[model samples]
Target: MLSKKTKYAFHALTYLGKHRDQKTVLIHDISEEYGISHKFLENILLELRKAGILGSKKGKGGGYYLIKEPKDVALSKVIRLLDGPIALLPCVSLNYYEPCAECKSEALCGLNKVMIQVRDEMLNVLENKSLADILDKE
Candidate 1:
């Protein structure tokens, strides 16, 4: 399940991408446009900025903008950044892998095997999809 934070990030990002022509977009505008709480959206945008996915300006006419072109920002990267490992099982996680404490051997662990397949299938889609792809679908 996608957290409200991740979902809100997408809403804010897609809005920013669509309005790329604008030099900057006010957080209050995005907040009201999407009905997201201003404070919550502020934190999300700040994290994205820190991650280098977004850039912001201060003072008059200041707001957030995408640093990378939409096509260059992969959905998987955003998901991992905001949601941590995409893999369902810690044991099967590629970047955040940790063996199950109860499972003595992953080679014989049915859950691990199944989750690996699940993770691969998910990556097949997420890894190939980008923010541009999402914008195109809109």
Candidate 2:
């Protein structure tokens, strides 16, 4: 399941990307536009800034903007940042693999095998899809 936090981040980033060259957008403006809470958006922006996905300018006319182009921002990168590995089972995870507690055997586990396929499919979708691709889709 996609967390609200991640979906919100994607919405905000794509909004910023659309307006990247125009100028930065005020948090309040973005919040109202997206129907998100200002305070929540502020926190999300801070995380994005620290991640180098967003750059902020402080002052009277200050706001936020994307430091990287939309095309350069990978969906996998965002997913990893927001939700970590795309794997269903921890044991099938690439970055955080761990055997399932109830699973008596991983070698012949049908669930693990299916989960690995799920993870691969997820990677294929997210890894190949970029913010630019999504933007173009819109």
Candidate 3:
């Protein structure tokens, strides 16, 4: 399940992507437009900025903006940044791999085998899809 934070981030990013030509967008404006809490949105945007996905200005004409092109930002990168590993099980995680305590061998584990397949399929879609692809759909 996607976290509320991740959903809000997506909404915010989509809004920015749609208005990429604009200099900046105020957090309050984004919150009001999407009915998201201002404080929560602020934190999400800050995180994105730190991740180099967004940039902000401090003064009157300042707000959040996308630092990278929408097509350059993969859905998988966003998901991994905000939600951690995409794999269903830690043992199958590519970046955040952890051996299952009960399992003696990952190669012999039935659950591990199934989870690897699941992770691969999920990655195929996520890694291929970008913010631009989603924006085009809309």
Candidate 4:
């Protein structure tokens, strides 16, 4: 399940990607246009900046821009940056795997099998969808 924070992050990024190479857009402007809180959006942007997905120039003309083109950024990457692992079950997650306390045999567990398939399918879809695809909706 996607968190509200992750959803908001994607929406903001999509809006920014569509306006890439244009003049810097202020946080207040984006917040007002998107119905998001400026402070919350700024924190989201900070995470993106630390992930190297976005760049910011401070001082006279400062805002946000993609560090890479929309096509170069996979939706999975963005989601992971904001939402962490895509898998619902931590045991099935590739990066953040942790066996549940109740689960004893992960090796032959049917639940693990189902979760693995689910995680793979989720990854395939998200990996195929890029920032370009998201922004192109408009």
**Which window of ten consecutive residues has the lowest lDDT sum in model 2?**
15-24
After aligning candidate 3 to the native by TM-score, how far in Å is the CA of 44 from where it should be?
A: 0.6
What is each predicted model's overall lDDT from 0 to 1? 0.92, 0.86, 0.92, 0.85
Writing each residue's lDDT as its tens digit, candidate 1 over 1-138 gives 878888898899999999999999999999999999999999999999999999999999899999999988888888887888999999999988888888889998988889999999999998988899999989
TM-score of each: 0.95, 0.90, 0.95, 0.94
Error of 4 at 112 (Å): 0.1
Q: State which candidate, 1 or 2, has the greater TM-score.
A: 1
On the 0 to 100 scale, the lDDT of residue 106 in model 3 is 86
Backbone clash numbers for all candidates listed: 0, 0, 0, 0
Clashes of 3: 0
lDDT of 2 by residue, 83-134 (tens): 7777988999997788889989999899888988998998898888889997
lDDT tens readout by residue for model 4, 31-88: 8888998999999988988988888888777888778888888988878888888998
Off by over 4 Å in 2: none
Q: Rank the models by lDDT, top first.
A: 3, 1, 2, 4
What is the lDDT for 112 in model 3? 92
Judged by whole-model lDDT over C-alpha atoms, candidate 4 comes out at 0.85
Tens digits of per-residue lDDT, candidate 3, 22-122, equal: 99989998999999999999999999999999999998888999999999899988888888899999999998889888889988889999999999999
